[model samples]
Target: MQSFLQVKHVIDYSKMTHIHLRDFYASLNKKPQPERVKMLLNYLIEDQRRIEKILSTFEAVSEPYILDSWMQYVSNVDIHGLINNQKIKADISLDEITELAVKFGEVLVNFYREAATKTDLEKVSNIFKNLAEMEVKDNLKQARAALFEEM
Candidate 1:
């Protein structure tokens, strides 16, 4: 089996995001709130697909460093630690899951927003802006839906 650093070295940002998300969502599978898990699962799956699309776009680009730099920048974010260190129990509430999901999206938004502002390349900046917009829109939609559902 590959070492942790070895596995990390081979995976790009999108893949890393996928791994983290999949693990987090899986943690909810055995929780008491099946309905909440089902609801969030839909979004998580869609999020992974969207990331794959973004990665494909990056693969088609001339400047390979754009994707690399974006990935490196995101890796520096603390969301990974938050997710990995979180302790989820079978009794965890939907509100807890919703909060974590919101924070997850916020981290992505911040990363992309920062990238958009920092990059000199218009292509890179546009990609980052688009991603940031997408993340914010989804986060808002999810939060509103969860609020209504909880009521």
Candidate 2:
């Protein structure tokens, strides 16, 4: 019989996700132009929304820290998407932008898969599945396109 001791250790996306998410948001902050800032901010807002949803779905015990961190990150973002009618931003090259996005997505997936192998908890397993799906949905394809110069 298979034991429930199949708990898997998840990949520590804490540092990586934080770093990449910060970079994406900071990319907007670095934009001196109001228009570019506004454009990127819109994308940031959407990402914040997605992150919130992801956090909510996580089956972790300490919800407060996770939620707080996500909230703080989103809250500090400048939301001026409405102010700029002609916003176009660029910090990373288009190719680089896609590459990083996809790489991060892959890391997320790998983290979940690794965690699943290390933990026996069904909840943790579910969490990994959800997290993996979220990452796959986000930026994996963009990275692939960027990597292959297909886009």
Candidate 3:
């Protein structure tokens, strides 16, 4: 079994992911882009903030035993590599932005799902499962918003 330190590391990593993603979207928003792209970026920024808050709640509400429990495995996703490859010019198209957003969502969803499977504790597993579900829903919402903007 992994040590409790590993569990803390995983939680910290998840929080860091959201923070980095939020900052990335914010940075993209600072550049001159079409209104549609700006709107999408704004939505993404807020979504990351919401998810980060939810993760914070998990830390606050979970029992000490749950938080201290060892995880079967920790996620090994390279968040930096994923974010670094998403560079776009100021004239980036709506499709390009949408594609990037989808990629970001997919990575988080997969990470959370994998994390859920690696935890034996029911509370910890459910936390990751719920996060995955939320990310999927957010992705769909963002896609619909982008589609509507195209019309």
Q: All candidates' lDDT scores? A: 0.64, 0.45, 0.80
Compose the digit string of candidate 3's lDDT tens values, residues 1-151.
1222445566777787889989888988889988888888888899889888988887888777777778766446686568876774687777887888898889889887888888767778887788889889989998998898778
Could you give the candidate ranking by lDDT, starting with the highest? 3, 1, 2
TM value for model 1: 0.70
lDDT by residue (tens digit), candidate 2, 100-126: 445555655665555444444455556
The residue-by-residue lDDT of candidate 1 on 28-66, one tens digit each, is 665666676566656665665676666565566635565
Maximum-lDDT candidate: 3
Candidates 1 and 3 compared by lDDT, better number: 3
By TM-score, the better pick of 2 and 3 is 3
Off by over 4 Å in 2: 1-20, 32-45, 56-91, 140-151
Backbone collisions counted per model: 0, 12, 0
Query: What is the TM-score of each predicted model, taking all chains together?
Result: 0.70, 0.50, 0.87
Query: Which of the two, 1 or 2, has more TM-score?
Result: 1
Query: Ten residues in a row with the worst lDDT in model 1?
Result: 1-10
